[model samples]
Each structure stands twice: as C-alpha cells, then as structure tokens.
Target: MGGATSIKVEVYGYSFDNTDLVARQLQSGMLKDPAFTQVTLSRDEYTPEFQMNFDRTKLALNGLTSTTAATAFSAAMSGSVASYYREDGDEYKIRVRYAPEFRTSVEDLENILVTNAAGQQIRMKDLGEVVETLVPPTIERKDRERLITVTGIVAQGAALSDAVAAANKVISETQMPTGISTVIAGDYEDQQDMFSDLLVLIVLMIIL
Candidate 1:
C-alpha cells in the first residue's frame, strides 16, 4: 500500500488450485518478516439455493406467493419513483418505500406486501423463506477453475523484493496440495522487468 509521501510494497500470490495449503504457507512467511503487518487469504464458493428455500417457505406460510414476495422485497430494498414534482424550477422524484427501521430484519422483510390479481395484499413470508447467511462472494472463472488470493502487507521502509523472496521461499518449502500452483504477479512482475532492463543496460555500457 502507498501513501501521499512514500510507496509501500505489498506482495500478493494468485493461485487457482490448493488455495488452502498455499494460504497456510504464506501465513508462515509473514510471521518471519519484522516489517510484515498482516496477511489475508480468501476463496469463493457458490450456492444459489441456500437461503432461497426459507424465503419460499415464509411466503407460503403468510398466504402470499413467490412472485409477490419477490416484488415486495425488491421494492423494499430499492424504492420506486412514482412521479416527479416540480419546485422552484427543479424536479424531484416521489419515491416510495418502507421506513428504514421497518425493513431492518428478516421479520420485517416477511411482512412486506405484494398486490395480487384480486387486489389483496400478500405477505412475503407467505410465499418464500428468509434466512440470514453469508452469501458466497462472487468468483470469476479462468479455464474452469476457482481462483484464490493470498495477500501480504509489508511494514514501511521494507523492500518489496525481500518480502516477495521470503514468501516464495516459504511457499517452495511447503508441500502444496495436488492441482494447485502459485504465481507471482502484479508489482512483482514490474520489479523483475525493471531489474532485468537495468542489468542489460549496465552490461551493454561495459561492452561499449
């Protein structure tokens, strides 16, 4: 991470496989760096139906339906602009939604209303389920494999190269799980390129 007056070096590892094992190895390397401040490991998983079932059940129990429940929930989260009112040459939208406190919990969500064909108000819980959960973080796929990242933060005045080298050594000594490989990228690649160019320039100067 960098600030207004100086640049700080951070080393990050990108991996497609055996993320858990690599994370542990990276964690160990951070412990050895006096300049190390923290390390983070992250992975992504997908589950579309996890909490959806609860929403469906809640709607069913409340004498409402899924379509109605969905509409109510959406409106509750994002207010709808019914019309625009002009005042002093300026126009403002007339937005409608439940009060913030009213829609703060699962119970509040279940109580949301959806209008039916018969003009009856249906509760969200009547047609769907509502359960609190950690929705899996989004993932981008490359070659049909999940990606994981291990990030390390180095203390001020620490050389990025030293931190990266230490991280690489630790990773190499650790036994990686099958189907996993770690790669150094981002700023590390730029540093490598710069170093290579400098060495070539020095050699050329001597030859001349």
Candidate 2:
C-alpha cells in the first residue's frame, strides 16, 4: 500500500543475518518459480569498515573502563576541543587531533596513545583489536524496525495473482525466526485494499 515496487516483498527483523537469510530464501524460491524473474535482495553489496573490538578484562586490569578507551580512540580519530581562544570579544575553538599522515593505516591506529587512570600510557593495540569488516551500505527501517526488501519482475504471461501466490507459498514453507516478520506489499497489497473498499461500498448501497 505504500510506495513499494509492483512485486516487492519486505522482511523485518533486528538481526541482520536472520533478515538476510530469509530474504535469500525468498529470492531463491521466486527465481525457481516460472512466474517471477530478475529476483534480487536489497542488500546485495556491503561497505568495508574498520571495527574496534575491545577486551573488557584487559581494560579492567589496567584500571581502565570501556568508556575511557572508547573516548581516547574517538579523540584520536576525530578531533576534540583542546582549548578555546578568545580575541576581540569573540571566541574560537582550538581542536587537536592526529595529522592525516599519522593516522592513515591500522598500524598508525595501534600506535595512538591512551593514558589510563594510573597515569600509564598504553598502546591501543594492547587493549583491543581493529578488524576490517563489511556492513550494509544502507539501512532501511519501518515503524522503527529494520527492514529488507526482495524485488522481482513478473513474467510476461503470468498474472499478478499467480506471482503473489508463488511468494506466499515460499513464505509458508519457510520457518521465520523470533522477532522477524514478513509482508507482501506493493501492487498486490494495493489491489487488496481497493477490493476491500469496493466491497464495503457495495454493502452500503444494498442496505440503503
């Protein structure tokens, strides 16, 4: 009923893997069916990211907390307000951070200094690891829940009702995990709403 494609299926869940798994299953089933073609999942590609996984035990032993370590890492990567300069009754912020050349590579990130509560300077590498990972390039949400879409093209001879029935069959055969749900949206949903409204009008006319 929303601004969805003519043949679109939406899956909603909190876990990325679970959502992807369900989407893939539906896409595969659609491809196998003769009614649908050009089936694809929305999240076909991922973006590379550098993720810092911290060790809480190590941090605790060094009299440091996760917050302290995270603050240091953020300051090094993103400049922080070091001081304020005032001139001519106007104030300016003096931000200090590592130079581009000093923070280009993972090695450089590991070398950034972190001072613990005990006044000990520790290497960032000792407390955590920087791993390269892939994440969804774009995240979509509906009603505050994460959503993924599966789109397909209807075959020339196939009716929209047939395509919807195929999709429903796949959904029925699949076991959805907890906290996950699916909806058949797009043109079919719109058609259903139109039919319901027409039925109501016909009933009112008969009563009158």
Candidate 3:
C-alpha cells in the first residue's frame, strides 16, 4: 500500500511560546514542496476555551469546594437533567439549562449564584475568576508524549517516494531547539520497519 506524507514535530517548553510558531513554520515549509498538493493543520492556532480557578480560602469560607464548584458549573453551562417527563407512554428528558443570554459572557459566569452553607447566595466571582485561553481543540498524545503532526497529500502522479523525500528534507533542514524532537511515523515509518525485517529474513534464508 502507498504511504501518506506525515511529519511529526514534538515541541517541548514550559510555556507553549514556540509550539504554534514552529507548527506554522513547518506547515508552510512542507506546502512549498511541489509534490505536496495540499497542506492542512490538524489543530487551529486559536481555539478558545475558559479555565476557571477558584480561591481555596474563599471557597472554604463559603463552605464550598472544587467538587461543588464543578457541579454548579455543570449545572449552569452544560445543563442538568432534573427528571423525565412521560405523557401517553412517550417519555422525554427534562434538562434545565441557563438561557443563552445568562451563560454566554464572562459577566454572566461571574454573576452566577451558588448557595452557601448559611443558605446565602454568593456570586461565583466572589469565589473564583474565569481565565480565557486559546488552546487546541484536540491534542494527540502517544505514550504520554505530546505531538503535533504536519501532513501533506502527494500531488497527482507523484510517487510515494517523493513524499518520503520531502519528509526527510524537512526533518534534516529544520533547526530544532533544545528539548524538541522529531520522528517520522505513519506509512513511511512502517515501511522502513518492514523493509528491515525483510532484509533479515532474506539473509537467514540464504544462510540456511
């Protein structure tokens, strides 16, 4: 079977200061190859997500904890299933969720009300803050190693070997920083492994 072009670049840093930069550069370089008809990024550069961090002291003062905070969040944003409604032998789930207006903005989250042990209503902002972050929607990891892959499809009539050559060119030419590494995987890596095994088998057969 023919192999698809795949380039794996693993960038490591305390902060992801260079991860996106390197990924964009690699993708741009691979696309310049004439053999590559198209180049696409698996993860977008800017994917937005919210991270809420709670103050332990404030939480304890309000008789709340991380677990309860999570529950409150889930109930607010994702909704909660209160009960099932059955009518004329038909059943439907009843989920109570916040309206779009009430859950769409940072102000809304800050204004969320969580009850205290004293049965007093407390705003979520009094306990924690929401941090906006641009993170990858999905991150693929193998064997606990974080990886970003640059994949290219070979142009029509281009041989699979051409793709492998392009991959090698990028691997050798790219100047990698400290703690970052590269490895070729997918069909190309598997083909190399198979060829090595075939060579051993032929050598043993001749000896026998």
Candidate 4:
C-alpha cells in the first residue's frame, strides 16, 4: 500500500548555524505537542573531512600561487584530464589521479607534489597543512537560501489543520532569531492554496 503524505515545515535562513538552531527548536516543539508524533528534522549527519590550509608566505617564497597549490592537490586527490585517447572513432578522456591507497591518509596527502612556475616540484606539506574538520553530508537549499525541513506525523485523532495550528503556535511562541523564518509546507500548504482558489471561484460565481 502507498504511504500517506507527510507534514513538512521548511525553515529558511541566511546561514546554516541559524537554520539548524531554529530547526532543532521546531523539532523539539513538535515532539512536545500532542497533536504531532514522530517529529524529526531533515538535517543530514556531519562527516569527517580534511581541509588543506595553504600558507601564503610559504607559497610566495616558493614561487607558487594559491591556485597552483590548490590545483595540484585537487589533481592528486580527485583527478585531472592529462590527454585524450581516440579509439574506433570515439574520443575518451585520459584522466590521472592518485590510487586509493596513495591518497588515503593525511600523511599521503601531504606527500603529494606540486609544481611551480619555475618548473620546480615542491612537497605539498611544505606549502600547506591539512586540518581535520566536520562537514555536512549534504546541503539543501531553496530559492538560494539554506533550508532545514522539520517533519512530523499527525496524531491519530488530530486533523491536519490541528497539527498545523499546533506547529504555528509553537513557532509563534519561540523567539525567532534574525534571518530565520518558517513556513508550513507539504500537503497542508497545497491544500490551503487549493481552498483559496476555490473560494475565489465561488465569489466570482456569486458576483455574476
């Protein structure tokens, strides 16, 4: 059997920090409300990432630009097209990338070589350092703004409107920080739009 539509409230903010904060608050509020159940946030888990921080002074001294260092790192870890190969009238890209084993650890990344304008090869570690950090698995955006979706299941005896109203009450009671906003979305928003259109049609018919 197919599943029913879910209730999703989208929280938009200029920055991820604010957006995540508001989303968590909304999720907490929904969970406490009797009208909602199974309240959850659509935020993805953060993953470990290694970021390369280039030392500008070292690059300038070594006769290298930031772009040169970044490109070299990217080529080693990700890949870059070296040339093209044509076989049977089909042209294929010849890309070059480090083997998985060679680029697995921070030490491996630091050992990658970078070429400078003077045709001299320098060790990446000498130019920059790799720092460990955490980043989101995926970033979701709407209308060019960062978005975090809060979702919930309405209780058995509660109507969709009741759930929405309860959510709105929670939102109104919470002190929203600057640059953060919320909108009730999903089936409920669509239903409201449909009803508004129907009302407009009915008014037009009565006028005629």
TM-scores, each model vs. reference: 0.60, 0.71, 0.72, 0.81
lDDT per residue (tens digit) for residues 117-199 in model 3: 77888788889897777775566566776666666777778776787778678767777666666665665666788999999
Question: Which candidate, 1 or 2, has the higher TM-score?
Answer: 2
lDDT of 4 by residue, 1-208 (tens): 1355457889988777778888888889889988876788888877777678999999999999999899989898879999999999999999999999998789998999998888999998999898777787578888887889998888877889888988898899878889888989987988989999999999999999
The lDDT values for all models are 0.62, 0.85, 0.73, 0.87
For all predictions, the C-alpha RMSD in Å is 6.0, 4.5, 4.1, 2.9
Question: Worst lDDT window (10 residues) for model 4?
Answer: 1-10
Ranking by TM-score: 4, 3, 2, 1
Ranking by lDDT: 4, 2, 3, 1
Query: Candidate 2 — worst ten consecutive residues by lDDT sum?
Result: 1-10
Which of the two, 1 or 4, has more TM-score? 4
Model 4 ranges off by over 4 Å: 1-5, 46-48, 115-121, 133-144
Clashes of 4: 0
Q: Pick by lDDT: which candidate is best? A: 4
- Pairs clashing in candidate 3? none
Tell me the tens digit of each residue's lDDT in model 2 across 58-167.
88888888888888888888889999999999999999899989777788888888898779998888888977778875788888889899987777778899899999
